[model samples]
Target: MTTASWLAIAMATIVSAALAQEGQTQSEEIEELEEIVVSASRIELKASEVGSAVTVITAEEIERRGDRYVSDILRDVPGLAVNRTGSFGAFTQIRIRGAEANQTLVVIDGVEVNNPAAGSEFDFGSLLVDNIERIEVLRGSQSALWGSDAIGGVINIITKKGQKGFRGFASASAGSFATHDLNAGFSGGGERYRFAFDASRFSTNGISHADEDDGNPENDGHTISQGNVSFGVTPIENLDIDFTGRYTRSFLETDGSIFNVSSLTDLDNDATVYQRYGRANVAYDLFGGAWSHRASVAVSDVDSKNRSNNATSFTSEGDKLKLDYETTYRFETESIPDAEHAATLLLEHEKDTIQTSSMANEVDIKTNSIAGEYNLSLFDDLHLSLSGRFDDSDNFEDEMTYRVTAAYNLRETGTRFHSSYGTGVKNPSLTELFGFTGTFVGNPDLEPEKSKSWDFGVEQGFFEDRLVVDLTYFNSRVTNLITGSGNTAVNLSGTSPAQGIEVSADAEVLDNLNLIASYTYTNAETADGTEQVRRPRHIASLNVNYRFLEDRANVNLGIDYNGDQKDTRFSPTFARSIVGLDSYTLVNVNATYDIHENVQLFARGENLLNEDYEEVFGYGTPGVSGFAGVRVDF
Candidate 1:
């Protein structure tokens, strides 16, 4: 079937369901409007009170879907696109609202994880779902709250913390491609102290990175091991201390590239990556919890090595250190009766360093910033937020960014109107500013990229909130986009504009069944009016969840559709040219059954339709695959 036909059918199903249950209400509870969002603002705010486009994926939903990788879960998010170059452990990139991959900032437990040596982009390839409690995605320009590299948005991943009592879990799974996964975690806590630890190991004899149909039959394999620890202690009544640390190591077999061509048939090519992250935080409250102070220090280090013919060919190391201090005060005044106000001030400093075998000298960059935010709530129905930041960099000119947002709720009509306007700035990455491999020379004179974005959306709830739908329109214009000219990097004089519409719906169709659907229409182009490569014009997804057998058994079905898009293909015999990639659909299903109070069994099937497709031009994708696992809790 055609892409249009699939989209039409999906839309028809959603519309028909809504109409059929127009006046009917379910007894089961729907998602609460009071859900708190921590990433949207300096202070935690309810989802209904935040003006930004936000999506939250909870651990419960992750378990139901049985997704081992975080990237798989993000594919269903609105206004986002995920592309993987090859098998599970290959390079993965995520673009938000047609923005570049490096434009999005990723934060894990308040620590920035984007690699400074690799264009400041966070690769999602090795990010597993272990120990993650929730993920909050805040869309649009967020430079006012975060610093540089947030032009597209921010993704905050919060891991599980210790609970009141002792708890632990263990799981094991074996699947197709000779894959195996093992995970275990434990947490324990009391009133004044808490701690948690988790570990995981995964391995797979994967498919060929290069398309096997091209006479490349060699299989590539990958393996990863990761560990995490979180600890917190309250030494006094008003003071708290917390610490978190994580380490990951991964090895991946890969196909080599010949000149401009990628994914060539090769036998001895592989890459190894090591990552370490640590953070320490202190918090204090005064004046009966109305005034708060926080101080934190974080560090991130990454080392990568690539080998050819069993010999090390290239290596790079990047490190970042950050320090932050913040204070917030909350008050209510008689001048504005029944209104609440919060003001926050923050000071931050960051240093980045990179060393590569190809560079003669180690490079370093430093930045200092001060930011402030003001939040207002009126009559429990209206919310407003304003924020601004000033950043001073040693290698670039000073920059100022600001954002304004408003959200109004109509209780009688069960409707909400929200809007935001923001300006963002992104400094050039280390590699873009310094030469690499003696081939791509850096441009020290490159200016920072700047952008202005705005979005408006309305959300409507029906049948006592059993069904909810949201529609949003967003537009952004970016200037000073850096591009490669000959062997040196240069900033473009023209502006690139991206505009899109996002639609999403959630409904409780039956007592034990729920449905979620989303569709996006994006028009993203370069300065010369060419479509952005790898960004599909249309994307849609549908997921259905059901519980049965006294709520002891659960099943989930998901469908994803990616519309045709353009991609750049490099060939040894021909010049690099734009090529069209065919559209494709994927179907996945998973089921879980609780046989005992502390034990459960689960199974998952991916690519059930056995579709043949490629996310990146020459890279291969997995076909039909299945897995079964058993989990135990104590």
Candidate 2:
């Protein structure tokens, strides 16, 4: 027994003879394994008993999927890859798998909203899927309990707690070029305390390619406004307190074509930016059954002013401060149900200030960590784990990362087996130090990108688990992947080879239908072999939802596929591929209606295959869209 334990004993003897001939029953294509998560092993279990690879989006699936930011509800995640270059507060990137969208990691209730002033990155348009209630996506490398950007995984944005009685909601939307949107929120509680508030506004108009809407066509569009407030208190229930605040004011303007002579006659720069964000949390339950504790603090203020009607000008104003504290412990003395033990102690501090006409980059960072994890489910379904992390940073210094995961549970024939091994590191973003302006130039000796990853998977649940099937094979090498060099000024950290393969399927097969399919195949290369710029190497997605009338009306459908990338540049003055971005497929539709007992009505349609794609080549995304809304609960 060695060959992965004889392929896990021949896949647990063909899943225990297919679960003794499908014991659970009913099968159209099984699918119903939805509650179990311990934040990747802070200990909770049940995203199929977690080996790793999890995705959960709830809140009634964000109200039947009519998105309002959060990168348009992640376009139905699966090895995600979202790139919305402009429209809705401009500049967006949510790369995963092939990594590099600031190395994925965004937490909300647990604090850490990235962006330590100059691209620590966390901009899913500053999140707001209407006071979200649940969203947990932990694909891999949770840095052994979340530390140092969780390296290509971890997206926990949980909000909305306080529903034992009072509630409220509102929504509005419009379509076509002059898109418009409005959102509203309310939450409540008693017995101790509870509160929530939300607000939003969005608008877009810029894309008139046929006749070229030029009067000022630097791409013509954008305006966004947002507000949020959340507060909760138990004061004593073993102590619990929370606070969240958000404000975003965007009036972004863009059209910098100093001279490409085609993007609407080389329009000159037009830019303005402003943002403010805040967070706070406290929870303590030590001495209780499963010891626990938490403390968090965060802040971000960015005001950017850039103008160039002719005389070139760019102003910079910044601020970011974060402090986080963590403590968690799970128990079982006289234990051994397959034993369980977990611990996490972390401390983090960061600061950044950048004032630049051309350089005023500053940084101060601090990190302290302690990680210990142990699990043994050996015979009940087999599970083994190990974890490690130690980091210290002031711009970069002490570092260490380690991980291992194992899981097996052929539960006599329903299948489940997983594997993982990891390591990752990345630091270096104050705009890579001086905020590389205009023609791209800034590299204060940049360097900070490291990696090593591995994953092997197999999951099948033909019926009992409800038609779930997943297959994964991943690999990574990465090593100083940042690149820059307009012309010999130095700093072009290369070397990469991030391989990938992830396939997914989730079927509920009739009971009001629900099917989700996924696929991702990447091969980001670059160490002298090029082909990794603007990243993209095939990503596919399909989602279907059904529930009509009796379920109070519901319907959702989706499809997205993107492939075709390469826009390298060493500087032929600013290369532009042979003009990449060719593969395109988009179609989206959503519907909801409950009509009473609180009020509900919804409609959404996007792209509907109005086919026109360009995640970033000549920039223009957002076509054939429509929206209608009505929501209220109290």
Candidate 3:
């Protein structure tokens, strides 16, 4: 059935169930379940209290999805679009609220990991989901809290910490295309110290990245190896320290196309990438726990090499170092019961350098930032937040950005009204500022892109919070957007505007059954009112999960739909040109059976419908693939 039909049926059922349960005892339902988030305000705040649109993916939900890459889990999020070049380990891009791929900032354990040599974007394909505890996606402009490369939003991935007791898990899976994945992890802790470690290796002999009809029958393959280690210690009564390190190495088969265009497919090519990230933090509490101070240092390194069949190679390398410090003070007032106030101050400095064999000279940038935020609660039902940031960059002009947000809760109706307005900024990437000599040239006069954005959303609870519905409308106007000129980089004169509406409904229909549905409508246009490339007008998803057999077995079924949009393909008569890519639907299923307290058997099938679709022109996507695996824990 079509996505609309499924939505209709689900809506009808929800309405009917709400009406039926209206006369029942409302007290029978357990309410007061609140999620705490740290991404919105840089401090722990209840999800309902934050005056922004946020989504949290818990580890439980991650495990239930049975996904190998982080991109798979993010695909189901609303107001976001994910596109992959070809197969696993290939280039991946995630756009939020119709923003450019480089506009979003991705953070792992308080470290920014965007590649400086590239377009200041992080590739999600090489990120594995082995030791993640939760992911907080704060949608919309976040420059007031973060620095550059946050014009769209921020994604914060929190890794798992050691618990009180010993725990570990190991899993192995094999699937179509001769895919193999092995992962293991262990964590344990005591009152004073704790440690966690994880490792994973994945390899796939995959399909051709180009269309098989292109006369290149050679299959492209990929391999990835990753490791993570973390340790924490509390030596004093009010002092805590932690250190984390993560490494990833990937080798991929690629088609020899400089711009990844359709007509330049070549099979005899390969590439390798290595990424390393490390962080250390020290936190202390003072004044009887009324004030908290933290200091952290982080480092990121990325090296990539591409080798062609003709025995030619090109290499690029990027390195970054950052130091940050923050302090927050909390105040309480007896005049307004249950109301509190918090004020925070932050300071940061970063240096990034990029070097490429193809460029005659290397490029480096340095930035210093100072920011502050204030959060206030009034009458225990209203929340107000104000924040501002100032940044000084060596490669660009100084920038100042600010934001204001408000959220109110209606206790009687179980509803929340939230709104936020913010400004964001993004600096030009190293490649845009200093391009390769013979291939592309750079324009030093380019200005940093800036955006003004706002979002208004309402959340309501029905049937005693068993069913929840959310609707949000957001708009963004970006100025000085960078676009490619004739072998050079230039900023556009006019502004680009994007507006969208997001709708989501989640219901716990029964004690053992759950349903989730979401839809997004976006109107993305250029300065002259032209449709943007590769951005769909509509996207929808529906998911259902059920548990049976004495709660020992569980199953999940998901449906996803993508609307038609614009793409570029090579035309025999016209050479390379723009074209319309067709819309398609996909269905997926995952099942798990618990054999013992420490063991489980699982299986998953992707693209069960085997729908033929192209996210990017001339790129191949998987079809009707299945995998089975066993997991053990102790």
Candidate 4:
């Protein structure tokens, strides 16, 4: 109590223990910078070095979850599931865990756009959102590096190349029943030379039901027209070139959704569709050596019609093609000395073509591929991933897939774990190998539906970095899984496997409030025991947000829950056209206000607690809907 006040309390206890050990080494360096990840092992490894389970949706959370297709921005991302039927963008479906929709594998800006005559799957309502800037979801089973629907995972959509300047904007919206008009374009000399153009004309007199004004059931009324163009060039400065074009046209009406989707006892129906997509790219980067290169190409087309109400009418068409190439090599030494090493190698080639035209029937098909991958890390938080692929088809022959991943982190309790195994192949669709109704029969010695999946996960985080958590568990097996007997639509009967569990979370919890959550569980049956129908054995999501002005104003809210399913073709020959779906919850709200400095004002509402579900099965959605817009920046 007196040697000069105990030397000033021992210099304040050694400066509070060196500021709590430099704040825990900057909170373990921001949790190793949020476990920096790269779409699950396509090289650029990290997500704890990839075992599996990778989810990222940037572009400012897809503009605050406003949704504009990328499968409605992955319906709140968490084991994913999106099923919408009719709303201008009718019949949109994206299934992850229960694995359908061709087992899911979509990539844009990195090519491989799926839908090769409906084999790999990609119609995410004709993908559009002006110009996607980020998306990376690598759930479980990536077919060893993306070879055929990855068996319920792998989606990459990255777009936005106009480095800095030469702005563009235009948007419009009308409510009560949907109406949209938009325009956009970009002009050269910014990143050397760049160009982009977009167009839209949406329509809807939709959603009001309460059955009968044909369009066939649930809400009714619709129309759509869309267009897109993208171009880029940097001729010098490391050379780069890009191109994109797209189109869509639609019109529909189906009796208030077939009398709320299969009840109005005697309602009527009608439909339409047309889609097209094209893309190209070339890139080269060689900063003082170690090699770098990339190349790409893609094309897709679809045509459709189905005018019925008993008057009868039908038509269909399809086409697709894809190719890609890559090369990367980077090396830095001292691997065993002072730890630091980076290495990577990747190679690929792909192709596809499919055709179908039917007033009843017509078919054509093709798919070919070859691939390879390699990765390594030695300080970027320990990582290793490898991949291999080979596929050949003209009716199947030659198949193989390989994968490996390892990640480790404890760098003082940032806590992480990873595991993965993949192999998938799903081929057969031209309406299941050349289709035709009123006497179902189509099968050209069908054989294709091999699958194997795996996943293991763990994640944790805390404050100096706004809480985050991730938990995962997954299992899969397909083994020639396709079913049909008595009329054969591409015969296949036996294997059907599925099992799952998932939980995801995110929290900034107030700097401006942020919270996101997810939960999913599934067990798909079918050993002829049926129960793979509308796939829902539980699903949930919640999101909340608030951020004012300086952050450029914001307000957001969302909630979705689903459960209740059964109707695997309800027997007795489509049992009066199977129907049974119930259990739903939906609510959404949004607002953004900048209103100045470049202008911004937004408003949104979807279902806003209007409930009354149905993702298909008697159709019903769109109860309180809304839209308001304004966005300008130059």
lDDT of each: 0.90, 0.68, 0.87, 0.66
| Per-prediction TM-score to the true structure, in the order listed | 0.97, 0.32, 0.96, 0.31
TM-score of 2: 0.32
- Pairs clashing in candidate 2? 15-412, 15-413, 16-412, 16-413, 30-466, 30-467, 31-466
lDDT of 2 by residue, 1-634 (tens): 2222332244345545544455545445433455867577765776655777777887877777676777767756767778765455567778777777778877766556666544677767545576777888776556766766667787888777664467777867677667777888787788888888878887776553211323434455667787878778887788878788777776655554434344433244555667676777787886774777777787777676777665548766566667766676765546456566655566666665656566545544455555556655544577776777777766666778878788887877888888878787766666665554554555666666777787888988765564577888877777776755443233345557767777777766556766676777778776777666556677676677889778888989876767777643222335443456666778788898888967878888887868766776555566677877677766
For residues 91-134, could you state the per-residue lDDT of candidate 4 as single tens digits? 67788888787778777666565665554467675456665667
Ordering by lDDT = 1, 3, 2, 4
**Top candidate (TM-score):** 1
Across 38-156, the per-residue lDDT of candidate 3 in tens digits comes to 99996789987899888898998888778788987887788888888887778999989999989999999888999998878999979988889999988889999988898889989
Q: What is the lDDT of residue 493 in candidate 4?
A: 63
Q: For model 3, what is the error of residue 144's alpha carbon versus the real structure, in angstroms, after optimal superposition? A: 0.6
Error of 4 at 348 (Å): 22
Residue 568's lDDT within candidate 1 is: 82
What are the per-residue Cα lDDT tens digits for candidate 1 across 501-586?
98888876666878888888889898899898988988888888999999999999988888898888776754467889888899
Candidate 3: give the clashing pairs. none
The stretch of ten residues in a row with the least summed lDDT in candidate 1 is 23-32
Task: Name the better of 3 and 4 by TM-score.
Answer: 3
* RMSD of candidate 4 to true structure, Å: 25.1
> Which RMSD values do the candidates have, in order?
1.8, 24.7, 2.2, 25.1
For every model in order, what is the number of clashing pairs? 0, 7, 0, 21
Between 1 and 4, whose lDDT is larger? 1
Query: How far out, in Å, is residue 360 in model 4?
Result: 8.7
